[model samples]
Target chain A: MEFKKYSKTLFFGATLAVLAGCGGNDAVTQDDVNASTDGQVQPVITSDGSNGDSAVNGEQLGQEAQNLQDQASSAIAALPEVETVYFDFDTSVIRDDSREVLDLHVAYLNANPAQNVVLEGHADERGTREYNNALGERRGNAVKNYFMVQGVSADRIEVISYGEEKPAVIGHNNAAWSKNRRVEIKY
Target chain B: MPFKKWIKAAAFTLLCVTQQAVADLTIEITQGNDRATPVAVVPFAWLGQSPLPEDVAQIVSDDLERSGLIRPLSRSDMLSLPSQKSEIYFRDWSLLKQDYLLIGQVRPSVSPGVLTIQFELYDVVRQTRVLGEVISGKVSELRSRAHYISDKVFEHLTGIEGAFSTRLAYVTMRKDEAGQNKYELKVADADGRREKSILTTYKPILSPSWSPDAQHLAYVSFETGRPGIFIQNVYSGKRRQLTAFKGLNGAPSWSPDGEKLAVVLSKDGNPELYVIDLNTYKMKRLTKHYAIDTEPEWSPDGERIMFTSSRSGGPQIYQLDLVSGETERLTFEGNYNARARFSPDGTEIYFVHQKDGIFHIAAQELANNRLRILTQTPLDESPSVSPNGSMLIYATQEGSRGYLGAVSVNGQIRYRLPSQRADVREPAWSPFLTN
Candidate 1:
């Protein structure tokens, strides 16, 4: 079941790439790749003017764009999803499941130094508002400390906690609460 | 003279027995001298294109009435429905026996999609404007602004600040199609309106406690498959994990001073209370009992603590002197009593008590050793007294769902605030706001 879930995620990612290529405007943002690559990086700038052999240049531009897209897709496929970190009720301690996810996150941070990531901490609805805020912060710091220990630069990671104010699920049951108490990695 | 002495002695003996019976029966008068004040809230008038917002006046009426301190007069019975101060006729309100009048108008502001709400409060007897304020927000905030105005009028007349601007945090649970349960942490206005979910999960979330500053929350989350305490900030969305011990880490209580937190952890085998300093991140054990000692609450003065323990076989309330480290049993009236909270004045303690096969709220006078049952509910638990000690909020099971309810400290009035969609539990009333 877990292997099927991963394969489905990869398939969905490839479909998203193909859809983006068909769309006319293709402007790559900083989030596209790590900026500090030590190889010969060729900038692919497309001509926006309507005059010079428009179809030919458009085809060439599409080919170059496809090459970058393929690179990004492969990179994403190689990366593991960091959703395994689970927190105990009102606790910030890293559990066994968290260790697996943290290992992937640490590897990603080590490979990309120019990339900055934000760790957002959350809590399930149970306690008072202020206490949950503190609890969320503690969870974020726990992840940050783990990455620092794994040779990632502490300055590259930021932590924030949204305590019981933003829930992923609206249901008021155990299933929803479990999903709400999580830490997300945003790059 | 001998015959007269004999008659006096017999009468005195009879009086003593009657007093003893009254003490044993425990009839508590929860109501105070201040009855729910009567006020008239006229529907808001529309000045421009849009129709007046739906039920703005009704929302304000319900908010005040549910607080058990105000009785909003019906609009149908009003002599005149006024939308502004000039349209109000004090003589008509006075004739209708209404003490106060609220009038408001919603007009289009310079900014598009924004509405300006101008409101006024009039003293019917004095024939003067008691309060007037203008607020600007999106049309969606109209109901919230109305509640704020009602709170102001209540405070102006009663000299006690209303909790209209305060928010309530609670947990809701529901079962899925496969029978797995989902839980969510929700925040809403004190009146149980405008609920927004903060967290949702399959794991159980318990014992959410707010910090004194109202900026942070500490709760127990079981998402990682074990109970641990976590703290999160509301504004910036930051979270920090405080502890992940083996046995248990639950029931976090913030110190009144906001520098430390008191929580229940069982790292040393038995559940006990520990205080963690926020700055240093160091924990100090407060209790060393082999029995379960949990639910620590700091006193208003921050001099001592009160908590629930089973040191004497059955669960009972105990007080710990911070200076002398001496513990004393506080409850002696019932075999099952827990979750004790000190009154804001520190003169009495309120806790859940089970007597005669029924669970209810009991208050003990610290000075006179007098105990009184304040609730008549069958299963009352987690009693949290208001800052003024005039009311207490607790959670109990209604059919199959948990519902939050409030009772006057005197035990005269009782009302339940149940959610229409989900089961609600674990309500913590915020302290009195300064302004």
Candidate 2:
């Protein structure tokens, strides 16, 4: 299911605890990605049309527009093939392989300011329905928090947990459960 | 209670006999007492012009047999069917090795449509009468009269209040003609008969909780394309939405006094337990933790609330005192423990505990912190206790279908109540009815 952008006060305490325990402090940010890839990185730009000192010649304006289009196209091209992240049973901790996919999503969100994404979280049907709903919400928030740390705007990301109500696959085996416990990035 | 008015004003006429094609829930006693006291329930004498509408003695016998505490003898095994103390011969029952004997008579009263029942219980070996009583009811209430007699006899023999008249509320999921799953909330007699669909929806419905007065049921429904908590009058079918927050609104449990509901809401932030006043519709947040905290259940005395929280890294049961505002963890043995409920008397707590990768229903004594697993089947969840605290009903898997099962508090006896076509789950036992 898709959800519209909703501004919520994301709880960073859990994110901080998760980061502290996982000890990877090397999460890539928008600035790092820009510095490493773009040769002519422009100055910080806000959501509005122009940055400070808006007066500029038409040639310079056209040149800046070209640069922005090139950066956005390259960012979209850099996205990973996977769009969904899988978690361990009963735990919302993101795995190493899933982090790469989330990084791609973060970069894409940064390049396209008008675009918003929804994180759909799900769980296996092994626990009580209400408890699984809470677990699914935690998993969705885990992904949302990761995007926040990677320089994605919190308002651009909405989350909703379907819990065990909706399964990606219809089976009771471990193979089905592994696929069901996932967060899909829908843009 | 106001529920009587609802039943009287119900719009949908109950098709009790017309829908008998789908078999009613039948109980299969999986285990029982090894040395159950052998008893004989003699067929009652009918003094009316026509045969009695019901066999009161037979109904009582079935009640006792379902309890698993006593084994009633077959009617064919009895040498004589006695209806009075003077007609019962002590040597006859003693020869059958019966420990207890029950005899009764039903006669039409002078008042039109009224019937009077007289019954007595005797100790066969001791040759002493244990109980004698007379009950009056209309002809249509014969089944209820039988259950009342069973309750009285049970209390006299076992010292535990009988739960024969209580009811069970559960959810059933089935596929509609369009091949889409349809969920329904149903209530049935404790013996697993006379089921009525209280609510039906195309979307999923979870967690059916009975009000303390047994008049209303509060559950989470996804009818509006989003989850919301709704309270509906079981008889009248009148329903009102309670919560429809943006993120999560689920797990509604009524307080002891029925003035408030403990619910889980995520509107403020992460999933947290909140107590909402029924009169004002105002909410008071109970937990401020970042980790998931939900599934709050009230204690019988209204002084404490037990809930499930993952604040300690993984989900576990926790108790919060409303008066003192002090919170303490209650589970440590398992890595996962959720959906905890307090026994009616408040002496013990039942919950779903995961052990060795399989989920089972478990009980923990509040006095010494001792825990005992009660179910042998894996994937058991939603354990609800009877009003008298004698039996617990929960949901478990039988092959691929979900079914409801009951187990005694001592874990000595067990029974299964499987649905005919749908998957039955999320059973909530109603409190003892005073009416």
Q: What is the TM-score of chain A alone in each candidate?
A: 0.57, 0.60
DockQ of structure 1? 0.01
Highest DockQ: give the candidate number: 2
User: Which predicted model would earn the best TM-score?
Assistant: 2
After superposition, candidate 1 runs with Cα above 4 Å error: A1-187, B1-35, B52-55, B235-237, B432-435
Count clashes in each candidate, considering only residues at least 3 apart in sequence or on different chains.
85, 0
Q: B357 in model 2: Cα distance from truth in Å?
A: 0.7
lDDT of 2 by residue, B12-82 (tens): 11123323345447666777675667889898899999766567887788778778788788888999988
Error of 2 at B202 (Å): 1.7
Off by over 4 Å in 2: A1-71, A75-84, A99-118, A146-157, A184-187, B1-24, B46-54, B107-114, B138-140
iRMSD (1 decimal) for each model: 26.1, 16.0
lDDT per residue for candidate 1 within B1-435, as digits (tens), equals: 211111111111111111111110111223222466788878777787856544556666665655556767876798777897668878888888888888888889999888888888888888888899888887777656766876787678668667666666677777777877788876665665556667788877777777777677788787776567888774465788787764457778888898988887544433567788788766676776534467788888888888876556456788887777777888888776777788878998888777875678788889986889977756566677665566777876655567777777766555566555576777776665443
Interface RMSD for model 1 amounts to 26.1
